[model samples]
Target: MRTLAGYTNIMSAKPGDTVEFKVSSHGPSATFSARLVRLITTEEHPRTAGLIERDVDAAFNGEYPARRQPIHTGSYGYVEHATAFSGLEDFTFQTWLWPTLLGSRRQTIAGTWDESRSLGFALEIDEAGRLTFLMGDGQGTVSTANLPTPLVERQWVFVAASYSAKDRTVVLHQSPRCDIGDLGSAETRKFDIAAVQGKSGQRHFFIAAHKASASDGLLLAGGHYNGKIDSPKLHAGALSIEEMASLASGAAVERLNECVSAAWDFSIDQGSDVFKDVSGNGLDGRLVNMPARAMKGYNWTGQFHDWRTAPHEYGAIHFHDDDLYDAGWSTDFAFTIPSGLESGVYAARLDAQDASPAYVIFFVRPPKGQATSDVVYLASTATYMAYANQTLIARDPLDEMSMGSLLVFGEDDVFLDENPEYGKSLYDLHTDGSGVCYSSRLRPILNMSPNAKYWSFGDGYLTGWLDALGIKADVITDEDLHNEGESILAPYRVVLTGCHPEYVSLAMWDALKTHLGRGGRLMYLGGNGFYWRTAFHPTLPGLIEVRRAEDGSRAWSAEAGEYFMSTTGEYGGMWRRQDRTPNQLVGIGFCAQGFMTGSYYQWSSGSSDPRVDFVFKGVNKGSKFGDYGLSGNGAAGQELDRYDPGLGSPRHAVVIATSIGHTDNMVLAKEEFGAMHWMIGGTENKNVRSDIVFFETSGGGAVFSVGSISWPMSLPIDNYQNDVSHVTLNVLERFRDPKPFSLPQ
Candidate 1:
């Protein structure tokens, strides 16, 4: 912090090394300005430059003192002499620290007071997110063009640049954003400066943003809060440009919530001293609302007791059609709770299927006197609309063996492939599915099981599996539920389901819609459930229906490939898959199938970040060293189906490869991590296919759906007999029960 008394010292910086710096705070009283330099020499006076400069603006709270000139700095620039010095070409680039995913990410300087803005200032970042140094001849000054990346978001980015013919690239690192949770922008590039080449002279450095320079390299772009720059860093030698960019990728893939979990034991037995245990979900499972399984004398009146009442809000993440939903993405987890509930300790269990050896459990205890908000509800299928439309079904006969069961909707009607944007194919275009797609070299998470119904989203035999875990979940028919869209997923810690729980009634979807908005949690056990845009019977109030594409096809017709260049190698935009901007809401890219049993899995060796990966309990650097390695499946480390084809940067999403397979298949993977997370992929059972994904939102609730259903029976019941089932259960268990401080014990 030496005041520049006219002379200058190079400080602790070398030609090829990085150093922190800033302009000395003494400009108004002194006639000279302080500046940083690339180098200082004797003959001809070598001058240091390569740094950005500007007058502090009113933005970022920078302002000129009364009766005094304002200090200027807080930008990046390169050292360039243009036509003023020797013909030698030499230039340096310096950057400012910018956060990517948190806080006021953009840099600001003083400006004319902005009445519209409370702070009276504006915010900004380099256009492309990166600056460049172009040094040639008389036309030599450095020209910085901002480069853009999908994951850099809006934030501050500091960079240091130096040029060398051997390797023309500047070295830089993306710093941590507002929170350690967000990884910063991680891209870096190299630039060759032809302006300051081998010029032999004593180079002098100037700063304090003196007068504008005609020969020194600088950008004319305006600033928000132009003020004297604060702590700065300078680097000698060229930094690895590519490495820097890789870092930004990490921030892009980070997830906000670890997971969520919830469970309840109804135990609703009456006429006994233990009547407080309303919906008797007995500790061991003997007393659920099992019409036939429970003792005849037990009363079923309290089955819904103690559970968060009707019309609950199930928090969920927003899912724009364009988001990445396949393998390996992350986002926020949220859901809504109903307005009326007897205050009690509640836990949201997040069971992330396929994530073995680790799980997440988050808990929430409502205020001591909190009451239920309102009755928000939704339908699960179009047939449910018939019931909501006032059509009623005869009560099931509790006395005789039930010949016909009530359709969960309580009415008679059916939804036959009714959503206009629904795209129905045996295979997913994003991955190599089995039929009706291009580059059919291999299947991508395809449901190849021969016995499955054509595009059917269900598989039988989920009871044994559900009971195996001792989870006292209700098996209410889809139509049995009601919703106002505001009653997301009321009265439940998390909405649990079997594999292939597709065929969502419009109300069911709307209920989920409310859950996410209100901050509920969700966990999809299987694939391909709730992938359509069905209609909730507004008139019926609680009925549900799907809107068909009107085409002879199975209602679904829009394809991600048709609307995006993603099918090839560039994922310019995939959100069109569901007509939503995924990054804005959900965090995944797409859904695929074929992650196999006994596949490999591993964690990134990049950095020891426990927050993003505490789920890897007991696993470490040396453990499972070869787990996520490249496999015979080229897709393990690279692209599988090729939609949005090219490798998405770490920022937008990351392939936390767990296992590789033949035909470029990575049996396991993890993707986007941020305010919201989308995990959508598929599987097949009995030759039928299904898919389900989780969309978590900013609040802390989520929605779980899948395209496949047969898997429930495959994994739930067979887990004891096979490793795949065990793995799936383990993963889902964790997702269903996430932890806030650490992985559940």
Candidate 2:
């Protein structure tokens, strides 16, 4: 509630790189303070239950005065043309609406009015789910009319409201396009007021929101609509029920009438922000806040599966009350990373007088040509960006089942709900109630900060484990690997990935594959790695797009004829659907997930192979490899991946260990089933186990997959001397050697 907030431009920066910070304050002038800190561990797990922070000397630790900044939220289109409704005795307004949040207090579908000034006209949904029309007479009196029946959310409906000033009467109609009879209704009423005329002159006309007067003399949004609206038409005269039906039935476009004042067609400029007025009234409007375009519209019949194939079917734009495409704030300060600083995780902690503190995290990498270490940790930045400031607590009801804790709410989770202006993740839904297909990292991602538990484990565990072992390793991000490709990993002997690297872009996938192909070593220390096939916009720096097309553990499925990304026009879905399953690259593919408890890994048949002797240097062959750990209280739980030859696992791949004793809470992923039955849980099915796999490429390269998200949490146990730690260190030490892997003849 304090009012100061900010975000950094980039997630990570190399030494000698300049980073910018953008801050905003809602109150009067306030001073801000910032410092550098390295987050060690804040895991609430019983095994690791303490907050730790390491300070780093920074030049900018003093306070500086700053002013208030604007925050833009919601998406809609607006027209600046001024017109007086007072002159017309009879006028009609109609539009196709697809409401996402019908239960919200109030929402505007389309209106040429200002609510604060109490003038003009508007057709909106009231708090009680009724369609209400309001007209102001400029003299101070406002006439109101309402429809009897409430509309359903996420359904396409044609809504029309008409006002006859001569008769002082108003009529409202609601007609569902589909055969859902209960969703359609109509009502008519007469007001006692005289002929009401709108306040003449330049008044605002908007689709998703009405204008409200603010203290700064700026027009702020009021009753912002969350949903899709199409083909808003304004007529100079009231039309009959038959005429309204014809307009809603697609006949209005073909047979133009003299009563039509303006009809805006949203299908013309599918990729651009400009909306054209097909009625020839020159009332073209521009889209604000970047509402999702090229979506399946009202006339869509599901004949095609891709929007590019049939552009007409994808004319709708999804608007969300929490949709924030950009912050557009000015930079408050900037800092250049010193050339001598080590490559690791760093944060800029901001403090203000009597206000809550803030932290902007970024990773520091080695110089361009510098290879200071034999090992490299690949930050799962793409996955981090995908789940940035997610609002799953508001939507998903199975929080305890998903988060593995009955009291799983964190401070960061509460912050996201209080300030929705930070925007939503791809796991969220838009204002129109459709799944969010795109996510951008250009804003502050509260959960991505140090010590913040995302999916039951934080990235700090991996970094802290490496620091405890006194290992010198470089750090690189998913974006760096994406842009630079294989060349970025060519210098490092071994690469380590963080927990839950589930989201992978096309370029990043090829880079890792190429690195493995040419004698490079990879350690996939997480489950559900390289699962979703994602795309990054070429021009848009920090935005990523995903389409949850065919099977997987998905929150929401993409609608038919919309499985392709609008940003890059490429097919989106699981990599397995494209015949490039993760088992082919890292020796394991996502199989099952459970959050109740974690189990331990047992030795597999391949563990007896003499060629893999170096993997168990300090571990007992008879004992369970990972019987104790931090995550879920064991090394294998949450989500587990398995090696299956039928799915694309290489013939030479060896499964050194497999987890056992998973509870009934763990179930097989949807993609693993062709038909649904009861034999999908870990207790019923043998496939719901993580396979610690090891395989060598033809060019002396190798791959090792831990196959569980909790595996790394087991590394910091016994002072880093446990069996899990031993096996991982053995692989890292041997993989870093200059000698090549000795393949059997």
Q: After aligning candidate 1 to the native by TM-score, how far in Å is the CA of 151 from where it should be?
A: 58
Q: What is the alpha-carbon lDDT of model 2 when measured against the actual structure?
A: 0.78
lDDT of each: 0.26, 0.78
Best by TM-score: 2
1-745, model 2: which lDDT tens digit per residue? 3456677787778887888877766545467777777665535454553445678877765676767666678777777764533344578888888888886688888877777667778899998877888777666888777777788887888888777667676767788776545445443443444437564653567888877654555457777888888778888887555666666566863333686777887777665567888887787887766677667888888887677887777777777776665676678777789888888877777777666666677778898867789889998888988888777876688756766667566666766676777888888876555788778777777777645655522666777778877888899998888888999898898999987899998899999999888889998988999999888767667778898997788878987777877766778899999888999999999999988788999999999998678898878888576878877778998889999999999888889999998887888988999987999988999999999999888678889899999888887787677888889888888888877875566
CA deviation > 4 Å runs, candidate 1:
1-463, 476-488, 501-510, 539-578, 581-586, 589-609, 612-659, 662-697, 702-745
Clash tally, candidates in order: 257, 4
lDDT of 1 by residue, 1-745 (tens): 1111110111111123222111111223322222211111001101211111122211112221212112221222112233222321222323233222222223321111111211111112343333323222222333232334422443344443444445533333334233466564444544333232333331211111111222235222122212112122221233245534532443321111111010111122211111121122221111110010011111113333211221011110011111111111121222233333222111121112131110011112233222132211121222211111121122223211211222343101111011111122312221111111111101111111111122121222233343344443432334333332333245544555434433443345456556655565554443333443333323222222222221211213322122111111111212223443222222222233343321222333422443334233433444322222111111122112111212221132222223222222222222221243333232211111111223335455544332222233333222334332443444344545544122122
